[model samples]
Target chain A: MKYRHLVITDPAKLIFGTAPYPVKTRRGLHIGGGQVYSELNFTLPVMSINDQTLPEVYAHYRQITEGALERALQLNSKGVILEFETLLEMTKSPATGVEIVKIMNDICESFYQKHGLASEIRLTPNDLREFERPALQRTSRLLEPMFQLFEQGMLAGGDLLSIESTGGKEVSDEALMMCDIKAVLFSLAVLGVRDMQFLWEKIAALARQHGKIPAGDSACGFANTAMVLAEKKYIPTVFAALVRVISVVRSIVAMEQGAVGPDKDCAYEGPYLKAITGIPISMEGKTAACAHLSPVGNISSACADLWSNESVQNIKLLSGMAPVAYMEQLEYDVRLMNTALKKGAAYSRTLQQLLVESDVYTDAQALVLDPSNVIRISSALIQGDSYVANARNGALEFIEILEETLASGRMTLPEMELSYIPVLREELQSIPDSESDFIEMMLPLLDPSKFIPSEYGL
Target chain B: MNYILSKLLEAVEYGKVDQGSPYPPNLKGMDGAHELTQKALDAGIMPQEILETALIPAMGNVGRKFSENKIFVPQMLMSARAMGASMAHLKPFFASGKIKARGTFVIGTVKGDLHDIGKNLVAMMVEGAGWTIVDLGVDADAESFLEALSNNPGAVVGLSALLTTTMINMGEIVEKIKENAPGTVILVGGAPVSTDFCRKIGADFYSPDPRGAVEFLKQLAS
Candidate 1:
């Protein structure tokens, strides 16, 4: 609850490579104070690993990590963050994830201790609870292994504990397809908020016990899902944009429950999270083109403390391994931003403006992410009385900015999409301000079997 | 066209599920697909005729609007719901063999993946096109697909995965299925799936949208 109101009220004051509050890792890596670090996210190629392939899996990870670090040194990057987002099998076999954690941490320490360079690891285990139908069984056997892996990762000298926990995804999946804003809000603001509270409480406690940084969670399973659907033209981009804003309430719960800054890279809602909580955020933009195609390639980096490549595989390319190539790309991107930062405040502001302007008018998803609009939407978020109201107001604020943008002839959207704005506006405005009333109204419309109300403490 | 049948078509086209649902503002307070469909049945219209002339065409229009970007997932999903309401009244006819299905389509999100919105959408669209869908649900492994195929011989199997990590499982699943059942036809899809990947993975088809999958199945049935 550190943020009662928006910390950076004036959008002009908000800049990349720094946050009002920065998170310092155990190895003296300051995530948000200054210097935009490159957070390299890499994964295995299209291969299955079993008991017989365990040794090969280790070899692949070693190659990717060693190759990436070698590139970092060549680029002369000041600091880098290696995010080891474990695959599902890694979590199932906790020893495998822990061993990989140990291997990555050893490489990072060796690089730092020998080369006088700094690096850290953000160990994210896949949230396996999402693999189940009910998806929210707190006591399920599948749930504990994730936390066990996190604990093991911390003990293995991993600096950050994070997970892309998919709490409300089961319900959000259906709501997203129907564009049911109320149901979407319930899934994210109510069900997701409760899950974040329960999940992050444990994670933050574990971090405290281990004296490690509990980096934030993401709405990747929710908003990022919508964005991908929208990108494929299956859903309206405006719907995805609104979902992104509303997602901040649930994601910020990670912060409220004692998790500190430098939230996950894929949480495109990171801008709003950063604006409200003053937590440094890791954002992936142009460099993330290796993972997925997105229109926010430029705007995503406008307020980022860590510029990331979403996750490239260890496959080889003309230059070298894919992860190594991506590390080089991320280093250059961070170098430009860090260079702007070093020059002075004016240079940083100019660079931020260029990043904002490059992608703002091209897409609705990008427009809502403009740092100035993030401040405005986040301000409305804090002023609201309840989580549901906060999510509603956030969506309304996003619509207002979108409408203003469209009305001013700054951006032109397709007629089909343009017509849906008023429809969404009316639907958002129709929602009751009280959380209970909103829940009561939405419960009947949602398939009771699709979600367990008791899981949300209804 | 019969008035009730025509009204049922409009209801499905506009996504009016029932008289209680307040969507497509213009159609509020009107008898929706649920009511019109029942009235059409009571009027002695053949279930297959209603499905062929009204329900199927209505979903076809919805899918067309979706592909053309005139409508998106929400509008199309509403239409799917309206079609579902109408289909409920026709299920007895289908079970009694009074109406025929095109073919069986078995689908699931691959192992190590739980995302199913896209898979569910394909199921809905394909089912709306008059096919029997055996949904294997999410995290369905290779054995699940083989078991489903053995149960429904000559069925088309569809595999889906949202993450690049889990999508690789599709290749393994496809390989296992091919090794066990050489002539099995498989379709693969998801955000990361491309026609190129489809060919590389030995899948028979890959469609970026549900409408394209329906089209491919229609031709296969033909």
Candidate 2:
């Protein structure tokens, strides 16, 4: 069984811990194990200082820490996603960097006293990296000791520190990895905690940084480390941490290639296709692929390759940050289909024939008619049209049927499916422009009384 | 006699770039805007007539559809492609002064950000609405914007930023633009930016989608 972790932090003491259950609050809620466990009831007091300044923001940090700890304790959470605003609020006053560090340590000690629970504290390396913004890099360096003190407090108290590597363009993998490893080492040394989880790939280099695992032995080494920690009775508290670390590594690898499907292969499709094609291919799969390929800019090329390939099965296309890029490729495929059909190109008949032959309707019809796997069908229709036009035409007729059904609410999908199957089989058996005939035959049966609206009123 | 042009416009409005474009499948295998535009031109249709009668009306319909949420990004892109295909034939006429672009619109994503989806959409929509666009691309700064403004006096400037961190840069850029070119119209957008934020930054316009930006530009041009 998979277990989910939740962490909560204390502002005054700077200690963090995981809740055994979920938490709820008036401001926000954290759900754990299908129930609300705690509420983040603490509010940041309005600062008397400038709103934009980091110091002013940090002034409210104490309140935030207190609120976080209280909420976590209330929820009995095992882990928590740390909210940065609390720390930002604490730095507002004219407190020296040392003062801030002391306050953080105090917060951590408070957690030890109150709940005696170790916390999984999450932090984004991106956020830390952002503090090194070009304009602030020099000033931040000058103030490094203060930051280090604060870091020390966090390390000493945090049972788990989740770090994210992807921050900005300047945050390279090497840099993020170095930063994460250093932070983890600091946590281990200060807090006597060996459990560290990374949210992105930047932290994967830590084991290597410490010393390379023997060839083909990285996974074994990690597992051994967990076992060693567990034998020391850290397992009950740190297993979730180990899982998080593993998830980060897996997610990073997946991001590099796109999302891993249930098959562990990258999915190259999305959800919009369901609305367009009525097929439910996994959006999660395409998302995985996007996360994998987006950093490298291979999304367009991969899509082009998918479109041009004739023998490829499961022609799932990956996506990018910009939906426009995907749309651009879709547009290109559509244009190619149009050009082939109009010129009566040899491929056009192949496409049209495929559509007529196929059981599925047009990409549009498939999308509208079926929402579950529309994305797959829409992508398939595009690929099919690129390869063969008769198939494309058949797909178009399917779209027409979908539109007609949606517009008039006349025919049951099963009835439509029943009517469409034979025609499709006939067309497939013999390639022809069977769309017009199919549309004509279906028109009489679409007499409103023939179908009942589904629960969604579609 | 201009029924072909009307049909072409309708095709574009519905994102039918040509007979083969599978979007808006209701018109599948029928002549799309691409074919119809070329056909209209081949039959000696005037470039201005194609622009005014076919392209503009078609684009207007698409814009309306977009505002109504009847269509979305993919559909709008198809319409834009169809408009672009038709406009290609009219390019020479614009150069010869037989057709005129309403005005120049300079656009860019604000500094410290590499995101461009929002910027590109605005550029395409504004271009399709018959304005010339000078896209400065992503991670553009105040100096670049100011230079573009100087080069194209009276041109409207638009800024885009998708990140919360980068949105702050927009405030600085807007201030600089106002200092340098007080008369220049500044349009701001992106996920984090709200109308309230736009007002705070002193930008002239704020739009959530491409069509809103295009409409704002059209109103300014007219």
Candidate 3:
């Protein structure tokens, strides 16, 4: 909302590890404007949690943290981000996630003070909305625990706050599978946008109160679901491509509300988010194979401020534990980019182009992620005055890029995927220009019971 | 084929729920599966024929198209809704013992995982294939599956998990189910659940798409 259109209009200027608005974290870790940092996500091995297991769980987290940081130091790392994504079990046990945050922060403090290794922890609580039947996302008491954990985590020294929020995912799940563009728009642009605004408002307020960075939200539940489905070949890649584009507006609402740069890693829509909003983003790519598979493995890091390996468990590997091994992998990836940055701007741009070239032609899901294409789509997005209009414009722009990309022989797509372009184009173009008109047309098509319009404040 | 029966099948295949549903714009302003289904019955078509010849076959084609990537989840859901619309008229006959459904399928998202879109899709596709679905909803543990199985014996249990975090629960759940019902056939699926993981967990089957689950159940039924 600060700026309505594309901020970084020049694709060459939109490289990773830097942004127009950089977020300076506590303990002297300046994100977004420096060399790319490593954000290592580590989870637990298969184990039940209770009072008896709490000690083991605490020991596991300590082992992963010390182990990874020791390896980071061995590589002469600039800094590190340990994303303490709390499990549902942790949240159910009061202050367990918070205590882990305290443990991590103390270790980080020791690392910074003793070894001069700057680091911070991003606390992402489990979104428990899906635990409820029908998931009363807007007004469920079930959701308050998540915010409580966030507040406690920040108080206990969590630096950056983010959530893989699922506000509009109930309807979006169906829309994505059916390849229903209009429903996807309604879910993301309307309901998801409003939910981000509402949820981020609270998060932003909390961040402001605690003097912590309110890192933005991710449409992982929506766009990532589409991406995974596409990767599995259950849905058209074109559909996933469009979902990625449409998701940007919803994620940007966090910035519009108050959250700032360095959006979460799993939001593959981060490049476009960075292009439009000029916020540094944390992106995961090929190394994220430990967590999940994706076609955006290379291109995702093209504009990333923090390069991540998604999440790996605390199991042992030949080299070391999974988290420590992935940390070494991530440090090397960012080291290459930082070396490129150090060489010169011309060399950095070349590296960025190489990253784009490697993945762009391979998958339609990766095509829209090219920085130039991101700027184009962001330009088309700002042409619309409303969220609905912007979403439609963005989706149409994705198809336009695909059509142009295919026509120019820059890429080759399957005939099945190629055949969907015109149909998707027509469907997107058929949407009304105005928000109210679009909503009117969509309401009768969507089941009234699936989504509560009142929750979206429609 | 009867004239009304043909219209009903076309309506169901195209996802026409009623004259009011504004989908598949080509079929606008026409009676959908809801009205045509009742019409076929009133025209003296047997309810079993409508269920078998029209609803079951149309849904089978829908599932096949889905498996072939010719269609997606929305179209299949529409076909399911269309089949649901048609099935409403045949429910009474099914209750009166005039018709019999294929066996039951009990499904749920594994514990600590709250994703249901995948599970729901499989349930809908399986139910569309004319099976009774006992949907345990989300966050279902082994006890819930056992309770549902106790209520519906010979049921095929399908466990779904959207995260690698919760997918491990499938192993525990599968073991618990096998401990009680040694002969139970279990199916596992989700974003992270693969055939290898399914095999490692000792589950009977794993499919990436809902249509594959439908086909597997069809083969099981056969």
Candidate 4:
């Protein structure tokens, strides 16, 4: 059967926001860490298997993609939804895209033949160059066969086929408006190929006009107008292009208070339905966040949180998904903050106060405030805060607690049996003030036999 | 004497900026590369000896550690900082011909890409390896690379691209450099670059990490 409906959810908002879920995959390829092809909107390692034409290389690619698909299928009870961004990046180069499609087709055909099952594939094109004729031509040609295959697959499975475009470049006001209109038409046309659902995410007119606004008050006025328009449109996926936290807070508040338009009761139905329907939902915040946190979660918590959530839950749903020992890290910061609060340490006090004051604590407030919660909240805070600047102080406070925990035997080697000790040790040693002390503490914790001599790397 | 040089090397390797900087724990409050280089200078140690014997070897160790994954970006950055501190004292000597740099190497990220971590790493490693680096920061196009080459003829060129989209720009850059400055060796690297891609783009070299680029430049200089 073919999956229906396409829902877009923000992965970052889900994880870091009051609503958190378990994720399975701890790591994957990040965007812009290596040789990146910007036009394609993805990053790849300079020395990837794609560079080689050997059969073994092709096999490796097949194996990896198959593994990814298998995992996604097993983990997601609803149907597999593959991210097009990375795949798009890998296949954007004309030759590579052709090869990848050929390989995917061959795989699907083989699977279909073996199981007497129908194979339906959806292609989402997000990066369309502005006025770049060659790119447009290549993209169109590449999409044609895929669309045909999707139609055939849908017919075989009693399903429907669909295609969606993120719309091309934001050119002139006129051009952007035309692109939006064209996107709706194109989506409808694709839907017409089969009995499929068509969903169009439009860029607000105010956003288009905001691009023209000057650097100051003009921009603010444009932003306010964009919010009003977005709310009016009931745009499910709205990106507040505000720079400061105050602005984000204001926008969110505006959204909540009906300043933009009538406030709708927010529910988890969109994600829940998308998960059940087997249709892919694309959200701007989630994809944008993934791109921002490409290699690591150093600068963007909003993005990193979403990636962490999706990776965790999706991986858990997939078969043979390896358990991420690093999940315990989130607890580190929480525990440390607790310890500091108990000790009434100055550093801890500031962090604890921030946690108390910030909206971030709303969900975890009961658990964090509990006198005897078993979960290690310190590491989680540390890991989460590692990417966002606002979270750094909390992370630092957690580190302080970790240092004290190590110093006091009360932390006990028994509790260190978890996978996070080594990582925590490394992080501790990386600190300037307590490096030697942490190293000394860790050696004994690692091996009780040589607590004295081995503590100094003897 | 060897012990002092080793200590200086250690200082640089661990990022001991000076006596005052309390980083890397083991050498807290100890005299760092800055102090040691000055002391070595005052003691009548030859400037060349300081560079070749003390600073270069220290940076080499840092580069090796980086390649082996024993250290990461932040650590490598610290070592580079330490090396820079030491190099500051020796730069004027090199300028006056009392000392000599290996050679000049021009580097820049390809057009349409603004990311800089990879480019910065390559630039630092190449500079630390004793070559003069002409860094044309992020979003640099072919003309900038060509202009730098014109000023420093025969200098090796390196192009960095951290985006897949920009890799295509690298191909155009390689072609442009070849057309304008024939015989100039060009190296391309970044997360998405491979040896095969280097060949496809007509670049002379490709390395996954900064150390490999530094080693390649060393070979070219030799």
Candidate 5:
């Protein structure tokens, strides 16, 4: 509202009340833009979710999304939308897939219905056989339970330190905010998720409001879809309408925020998969919003500068996964992450306790012991080349906070993480942070690591 | 100093395709790799000299830049485009025996992986370095590699994969290629691949960047 072309690279920065000042990366009517990015990794251990907490979990998911979209509407006058990986998650049971698809459809249909945009939106049928067959075929029955566990872990951080009870849990306005793994999983599923067509279809009508879905700007996971498509030798027939739901929501905010800067950006990096399948269209007025393009081969290493929405889309249409050496970059980045973690652990007990578990010191230790969520944050930021402010890596944040808390002697690392809950509660659109499941989600970003110095060796 | 060759190298590094191509705006309307190579040849410069002095070194510079994160895919591909345009002029010489290749490199994305950007980059770089390239294309299984090796004896085979799942095929392909021809020097590169992976799979070498692959070929040929 205060500026033209407001673009956010790291959502965490915003959540931390450090939203970056708008910068013009390209020329266009960039009303509003935010990098609503997420990442997922199979290397992290997964956790199970009980049937009892499904309703609360679903509600929390809805609150985070609906809240974000509503704010997006305030910016662009058109609310963004969201979609879950129900279809891919349901691959273990085709019948269950059908049931979950119906639920997802209801979720989208209701959102559009409430917004009076339902008539414009169109959802698709179960179409796993087309682009996702290879992924589905690679599915092992043994891994089905693990996927469910991953979903649970993603939806609610691993039976986290703070989330003791889902039933009738009193969420006060003062509690810290947690992250939902669903968003991370939503993008991560591109590697080989089935029935994405159903999700993409729901996003189609939503695209009419914004025009083309800026794929790369959505997240690092979008580029991974190109690998999936190339592997399946599949190309989507309909390209313009589909976008990552997170982007659909964030762009609405970018639009409504209504930055009036010269050459305000509205175009973003098109998903590489779209280059093969989407009909070429001029991004002139069809430019929707800016997004983040990220690394796919391996998550956790800084690879390339974050592509602006302008160059990202133009580049994708120009080429389709032509110079494929990202995997090499991933390998190179992991070594760096290990080095950082090893170093940060040496200088601080805050980091050390994260790795060690003490019944007395619960919160930070919980995040340290559970590294999956931490990796998710790492995965989200590893692919960024550079940003207006900085990229979000939980470990790096931990390291930074660890250094600050030690120097300032003001708040402990766990207290610093807990401190943000109130801010998230204030900033969130729909639900209060007290009601949300964010402990495990925020832990990796908020906690100090427990790395023992390499010199100490113990 | 070969003034024309240096211009050619600069053209290849900056991705000046030809006089009319509108990319790399700073170098617009200037003679590109396409024009410079032809001019170098017209000046009686040997095709081998152009490959060595201009094309190879230029691609090497681009490859190193890519490793250092100084450039990205679009820029690298633009460089490749420039290299490809210049290399086109030398094809006839290679075919007619006027320019002898340093070696032959057979490359593909390996079985189970259809991604080819990395493979193509390596292919262009090796080709720019004066090696004959037999591209097996994506989804290449063991048989295609073995067949390529049989057709071009002493040809170095390159394997590429972009996914961890797809990368598994490299080991299988290497084992089969070694079984078929024990002395075949196989090179592997890709996102999930590492030098450790190459050694474990019994491949001769693995490079994280395209320039490294070119370096290996240069060493092998010597």
Candidate 6:
């Protein structure tokens, strides 16, 4: 009777198109539906060209610079994010990344100078792989000039003065190296270098000591440095006191902000609590809330061309030619659970098994013990990607399960599958709606003449 | 290249489909690839010459330009369409063995990924280079790849996936094809696919562009 629209949802009254469940239960993790996860900033120039020469890449930046700067200004962002990794891959050295920082700084400086824009613009560096070299020695090579610019009070030209390496990797090696990196970051932060990011690692352990909700800081250094800026406190005192904030912020965000529950999600990745706590996140971490004068910049990159192509939905096929600026938002926790549950079934493990068996548990092992808590906490941290990755793996595993079970008459999906899919499609359709400029971007490519559904007569 | 084949080359490069096709409007009303290819054949031009000297070289230029970003997807697609128009006339000759095709090539986008643009481009470019292409379309799984290889013994198989999620699916398809058709040459590609991925999966060949695959096939035939 309800087959007319195919996708059915009564959002206010129904959970799963009328299957009743209490509000925002942890059990939501056991089912599947469309999820509104963070649509990340898949900034332009990702996967646009393969096997590119250095000149080609630089030419690509020049071609897109006007458009990119215009979009940044429209968004009121301090500056833009660029894919320096491409250049680094071309050079294959940490010192090269630093060299690229200077090149990028030149680009930003020229953009600001030419535009005659009064507000300073910066470029955010992302996907930093250089954990070791380009040390204080190398940093000073670039920094000394910046310090001179600051001394001359002519540092207003937006340049990538900051560095970001998402903590806890090869960057997490030693007290000496970590201290060295932090020491350089601190010096640059002082001399009007822009805010750097991915400096927060193992922040959960630190959060517990401060009686904060134990959350790992994927962007740890944000809250830490924000506190320093807030207290006008000695930088080391705040850095020493820094702990994970996203989970705490998420908890407060979920409880205090009613919009972030079962039905509603934050319209943008607003640091609502960061405003209250006076902790800066993201670009704020870089700027120290503009507390530090004209800090260095960050020029990060995006991948997959997934969100980068502005016309992706209409294009039927996306290439890097017409790139769109993108940003991400944290989906309501309930939605993450439901998505992990339903979509994850086709992957390596069920949501329950994912919690019990897979490394999803150990990913947050020291962080938390509860499965639901792990989903909430780990999903906000670096561990979330692996969960989605697990589902992708589950997609392959589900194929095997379907094959073996269908062959042996041992397994069939729960009967709810029929009613469930339309909702899944409906939820997926919302992605385009939210990204209205490229409304069709998230939809799978379709050619009725050629594309046949995997489930035909179900 | 001879005059007729040279015209064919220009037609493919500029995406002049046929005299009737309105694309590449400057070339409209002129003899297009469809007409020029036919004219070459009627003038006693060998099919091998049309492919080697004209079609292959034209597609090679297109591929090089693509890598250089002188052309993008829409342009590449246009060129592929023109190439297809010409290949339509040659397919019959290859079927009858009047014109020798080096070998058969079975190609498809892997299961779970529906993107066909890249796959289609590769297929068209490869076909232009004189191989008989059996395109299985998108969402082709390991079983389908194996079946395609079985029907065309000694043919090369190409698997494509655009999503990182589905790129893993390529590994399964490659492994299955290798296991079932142990001797079949496998070429893997797509946006995310790298030569490193090719080596990791034990696939025999990987190309970022369709021209690379075509050149690899040509080398094998030689």
How many angstroms is residue B151 displaced in model 4 relative to the true structure, after the best TM-score fit?
Answer: 1.3
- Best candidate (score: TM-score): 1
Query: TM-score of every model?
Result: 0.95, 0.49, 0.91, 0.46, 0.42, 0.38
DockQ of 4: 0.12
Model 3 reaches what TM-score against the true structure?
A: 0.91
List each candidate's DockQ score: 0.65, 0.10, 0.41, 0.12, 0.01, 0.02
Error of 6 at B119 (Å): 2.4
Poorest stretch of ten by lDDT in candidate 4 chain A: A32-41
Model 2 lDDT on a 0 to 1 scale: 0.43
Q: State which candidate, 3 or 5, has the greater lDDT.
A: 3
lDDT of 1 by residue, B1-222 (tens): 888888988899889999999988999899999999899888899999999999988888888877777888778888889999999999999989998888999999998887788899899899889889999999999999899889988898899997777898999999999998888889989977899999998999999878889999999999
In order of listing, the candidates' clash counts read: 0, 105, 1, 51, 40, 29
lDDT of 2 at B194: 88
Q: Model 4, range A8-51, lDDT digits (tens) per residue?
A: 23322211111222211111211111110000011222223335
Looking at candidate 6, what is the lDDT of residue A242? 17
Q: Across the candidates, what are chain A's individual TM-scores?
A: 0.98, 0.27, 0.98, 0.28, 0.24, 0.28
Task: Write candidate 5's Cα lDDT for A1-458 as tens digits.
Answer: 11122233231221100113321221111111322111100110011122553454344334433443343333332222222232222333433333433443455356566764221111111122222212232233423432333233222211100000010001100010112222222222211121222222223323333433322112222322332222221211011111221222222222222211111112212111111111111111101111222212111111111111221111111322211122122222323333334454332223323222222122222221122323333333233222110122222333343344345653343332343333322232221122123223433432222111111110
Model 1 chain A weakest lDDT span, ten residues long: A131-140
* Model 3, C-alpha of B141: deviation from truth (Å): 4.5
lDDT of 4 by residue, B1-222 (tens): 566677788899899989998777789989999998888888788888888898888888878866664554456677888888998999889989998888888998876665454677688888888888999976788899989999999889989886555777898889999999999999888866789989988999898767778888888777
> lDDT score of model 6?
0.41
Give per-residue lDDT, candidate 5, residue A331: 24
* Candidate 2 C-alpha lDDT tens digits along A287-370: 223222111112211111112110111112253212223223323443443444455535544543333224233222223223
The Cα local distance difference test for each model comes to 0.88, 0.43, 0.86, 0.41, 0.41, 0.41
Please tell me what DockQ candidate 2 reaches.
0.10
